[model samples]
Target: MTKLLLINAGSSSLKWQLVNMPAEHVIAAGQVERLNLPGTIVKVEVGHQKTKEVVETLDEIAAIDRVLKRLITVGGVQTLDEVEAVGHRVVAGGTLFKGPIKLTPSRIDQLRGLSELAPLHNPLEVKCIELLAQRLSGVPQYAVFDSAYFQGLPEKTAIYGIPYDWTKKYQIRRYGEHGISHQYLANRAAEMLKRPLSELNLITMHLGSGASITAVKNGQPFDTSMGLTPVTGVMMGTRSGDVDPTIVPYLMKRLGMETPEVVIQELNASSGLLGVSGVSSDMRDLHDAAKSNQRAKLAMDMFVNQVVKLVGGYYTEIGGADALVFAGGIGEKDPVIRQSIIDGLGVLGIKINQKLNEADHTGFLEAQDSRAKVMLIPTNEELAMARDVQRLMDAEK
Candidate 1:
C-alpha cells in the first residue's frame, strides 16, 4: 500500500492531498488558510466526510503539523509512517532544475540561490520542504517545479532583448511561470479533442489573481506571457504587468521615491485593477462597481482588452490555434467575462454560443459553427505534482 502526499504551500495558505499510489485515489485532501493570523481556518475532507475548524497556527509548519495529525485522527491513515513519499510544488527551479527531481541538501541549497527569481513564492515553499523533512525524516521527497514545463521553449522566445553579455552572465531570460497548469491543460485538451497532444496547437489562459497565458505548440510550451517572474504577464488583480521599464525611473523622480525597490513595490502591490478601479481587485467586485463607477468600468475594459490582445497575438504566433482553453478563477466561474473575451475575438472567426455559455454547457462553450474550439478545462497542479512523483518513484524500481 504505497501512499504519496502532495503539498502546495504559499505564504498564507497550505493545501495538501494524500493519495493512494498505483490506484491514484485521493484518500484525504485539506488546506489551512490565513496562517500566522487570528481566525485562521483549517478544512479537511477524507473519503465521504468533510470537516472545518478554526485553528491556531503560527506559520506554515504549524499548519502542516495540524494536517498530518488530522490524517491520523480521521483514520485516513493509521499512522504517518504509511506515507512512503512526499511531493512538493516548487515555483521556480531557475537554471539548475528543468524537471522533477529528488530533494537533497545540495539541491535545496540550489533552490535557495534561485529564491531571488521568485521572491514571493520560493522562500515559503522551501520552509515547507524543510519542515516536512524534519517531520517525516525517512520519507523520500521530490520537488516538482512549475518552471520545468517551460524550460523547453525555443531560444528566440526565451531570450530578453537585453545586452547579450548581460543576458548570458546573469541568466536573464524569460522563465515563464504557471507551467504546471499550462502543461495539464494541454494534455487535457488533447484527451477531450480525441487527438494526440503532440499534434495539437493550444492557447491556455490561466486567469486568476496572478494570471498568465501560454502558447503550446505540438503540446509543448512554445511561449508564455510571464518573463523572469510571474509579475510580467497580463494585468493581474494587483500586479502591474507589462509595464514600460522607463516608468520606474520616471516614477522615482516624480514621486520622490528613494529607490527602484519603492517603485517596484508599488507596481506589485498597488497597481493593476486595484489602482485603476479604485475599488476591489476581485473580478466580481470590479464588475459590480463597473456598473456605477467609470474607473471600475475602465479597469474591466482594460483587462478584457489585454486578454484579447494576448490571445490574438498568440493565435497568430502559433500559426492559428486549434483550441483556446480557459481555466483558473475568473475563467471558470464568470460567464460574462468569458463571453466578453470571446466576443472580442469574433473578428478571428471565433464565436461563442451565447445560449450554451449562459446555460452551463460542460466544457465546450464555442458555437457549433465556430472556426476554433474554446474549452473550459479546470487545472489541477497538485495532481500533476503527484503524477510526477509517482513517475520518478517508478523509475527508481
Candidate 2:
C-alpha cells in the first residue's frame, strides 16, 4: 500500500500522520504529548476515531518508538516496510533551503547547525530525523522547512535597514516561520478562490499555538511578520513578538541581567497570550474563562487586535490584497476571533459572512465570497509534505 508517515516534532510534543503515499488518504494520525515528562499522553485518531493513553515518562526517541509500534501492532500494519518514506518538518531552513530536501548525512548535520537560529524547534526536528532513520532503516526520509519559502523574498524586503555589511557577514534576514503552513495556505487559498495563484494577493495567517502572518502576492511571498526568528511576529501563545531593540540594553543596565540570551528566552517562552492573560496557553481554556475574566478578555482582544493590525499593514504593503485567509488550530475553529478581525475591514472590501464564519462543519471552514473572500482553511501541512515527497521521488523514478 506504499504508506508514508509525516512527523512534526515540537518542543515536547511529537505529532505524526500516516497516509497512503501518493493517494494521500490518512490512515491514522496522532500526537505523543508531554514527551520526556511524567504522565506523558499518547493520543491517536484512526479512521476518524480518537483514543488517548497516558504512560510513564519516555524520552523523545522512546516516544517515536511507541508511536511506530502502535501503528504496526495496534493499528494492524502487517509490515513496517510498507512505510515507503518518512517526512520531517525542519523549522529553520533559513536561506540554506528553499524547499523539501531528501535527508542525507550532510543535509542532516546542516539542519542541526541551523538549530542555533531556532533553538526551540530545529534541534527537535533534527532529532526526529535521526530517530526515524534509526528505526525505519531503508525508508527515504525528507525534510520540509518552515523558513524555506521566505528565502525567495525580495532583497530589499529581506535586508533590514541596518549596517548593510553586517547582513553579508551574519546572513541575518527575514526567514519567516510557519513557511509550510503559510505556503500551503497561500496555494490552497488560491485554489478555493478559483483564481490562478499568480493573479492573487493574500494575507495568510497561521493562528495556532504559535502564530505568524505572511503577505503573499503573485504566488510568492512579498513580506511576512516573522523575521530571522519565529519570535518576531504577532503575539503568540507564549512569544513576545516585535519587542523594541532598545529593551535589551535597558534591562541589562537596570536589572544587571547576565546576558541578552536570558532575556530573549523569556521573550520566546514566557510571554504572549500566557503572559498577558495569566492563564493557560491553550485558547480553548482562555475562551472559556474570558467571559467574566477581565485579563483573559484583554488577552484575546490583544491577540485579535494585533492580527488585524498586521493584516492592515500587509494589505498596504502589497498595495491591495484580493483575499484574506486563516489557517491553523485557532484560525480554523475560532469564528468569533475571525469575525472580530475582519469586522473593521468592511471598508476595505473584507467582511466575514457571520454564518459562514460561525458554522464549524467538523474539519475546514470555507467561507462565502461576500466582499473580500474569507476562508478558514484547515492547513494540511502533512499533505503538503507528502506532495513534496511525491515530487522528489518522481524525479528519482
RMSD from true fold, candidate 1: 2.9
My TM-score estimates for the predictions, one after another, are: 0.89, 0.90
How would you encode candidate 2's per-residue C-alpha lDDT over 231-348 as one tens digit per residue?
8878887787888989887888887898998878778777888788898566776899898898898888888889888899888898888778788778877888888888856557
Count of clashes, each model:
0, 0
User: Which residue pairs does candidate 2 place in steric collision?
Assistant: none
State each model's CA lDDT, in order: 0.86, 0.81
Best by lDDT: 1
* Candidate 2 least-lDDT 10 residues: 361-370
Candidate 1 regions with alpha-carbon error over 4 angstroms: 10-14, 31-43, 48-66, 73-75, 359-361
- Measured over all alpha carbons after superposition, the RMSD of each candidate to the real structure, in angstroms, is 2.9, 2.8
- Model 1 TM: 0.89
- Candidate 1 positional error at 245, Å: 0.9
